[model samples]
Target: MNGSGKDDKQRNRVIAKNEAERQTTGDIRVSAWTIVFAIIVGAIAVYIVWAWLHR
Candidate 1:
């Protein structure tokens, strides 16, 4: 058999690995942003409730 088959498999494996790493890093950034927004919203909610109760 020609060696072309092994080379194709190796190329496919590398492509898949790179895609996986890209997706993982993308998810991490999204998760960080989500956490930041969640904290901000929670703080705003607490402020609103405190102001409502005191006023």
Candidate 2:
């Protein structure tokens, strides 16, 4: 038999890997601002409760 089938399979694998890598290169899967906003909201909640308990 010939080796074209094996070469085709290898090329397909390389193309798929490159595509997956490209998709994630510029993608912000997690936003830093979202995390910061959540932290700020949590701190505000804690401070409000602390002030209420002491006042």
Candidate 3:
């Protein structure tokens, strides 16, 4: 009974660690995408402004 309990605890720990890692990776992916989107939008805005001013 004691050995079974220890095994359960170990399994739970592994699952929890996996979940935390997945969450962290998801957050990083979202942040990276946001940064990419911001850069693209900024470039477009600059281009529009330049074209308007020059023309």
Candidate 4:
């Protein structure tokens, strides 16, 4: 019974680790896309301002 309990605990730990790693990867991907979007928006805003000033 003790050996079975140990195996269960080890299995649970491995599952938890995999889940955490998956979440971390997802978060990084989202962060990268967010940065790209922000950069595009900023570029558009700058161009608009420049055109207005020139006109």
Candidate 5:
């Protein structure tokens, strides 16, 4: 409403560029316990499906 279409496009481009830069520089940190828990849950799910199919 306040600005023109070109201004909106430029603002959107700047926002997208910043987001891209942040993602590239970001570090993903996952804890060991989280990984272990996920694996345990996945194994349980697989076991349940296997038991269901066999029985």
Candidate 6:
């Protein structure tokens, strides 16, 4: 019984660790995309303003 309980605890810890890692990876991916999108938007805005002023 004790051995079985210990195994369950270990399994639960492993599952929790895996879940945390997955979440962190997802967060990093989302952050990277957000930064890329922000850059594209900023570039577009700058181009529009420059074109308007020059014209």
For 1-55, candidate 6 gives per-residue lDDT tens digits of 6999999999999999999999999999999999999999999999999999999
lDDT of 1 at 13: 100
Expressed as tens digits, the lDDT of each residue in 1-55 for candidate 5 is 5579889999999999999887765533345567788999999999999999999
Q: What's the lDDT of the predicted structure labeled candidate 6? A: 0.99
lDDT, candidate 3, residue 50?
A: 100
Global local distance difference test of model 3: 0.99
lDDT of 2 by residue, 1-55 (tens): 4699999999999999999987776364456667888999999999999999999
Better of 3 and 4 by TM-score: 4
List candidate 6 segments past 4 Å from native. Answer: none
Pitting candidate 3 against candidate 5, the one with the higher TM-score is 3
lDDT of 4 by residue, 5-53 (tens): 9999999999999999999999999999999999999999999999999
- Lowest summed lDDT across 10 adjacent residues in model 1 is found at 1-10
Worst 10 residues of 4 by lDDT: 1-10
lDDT accuracy of residue 23 in candidate 1: 100
- For model 2, the stretches where C-alpha displacement exceeds 4 angstroms are 1-30
In order, candidate lDDTs are 0.98, 0.86, 0.99, 0.99, 0.84, 0.99
Query: CA shift at 6, candidate 3, in angstroms?
Result: 2.0
Steric clash count of candidate 3: 0
Runs of candidate 5 with Cα error greater than 4 angstroms are: 1-30
Off by over 4 Å in 3: none
Clashes of each: 0, 0, 0, 0, 0, 0
Which ranges in model 1 have alpha carbons more than 4 Å from their true place?
Answer: none
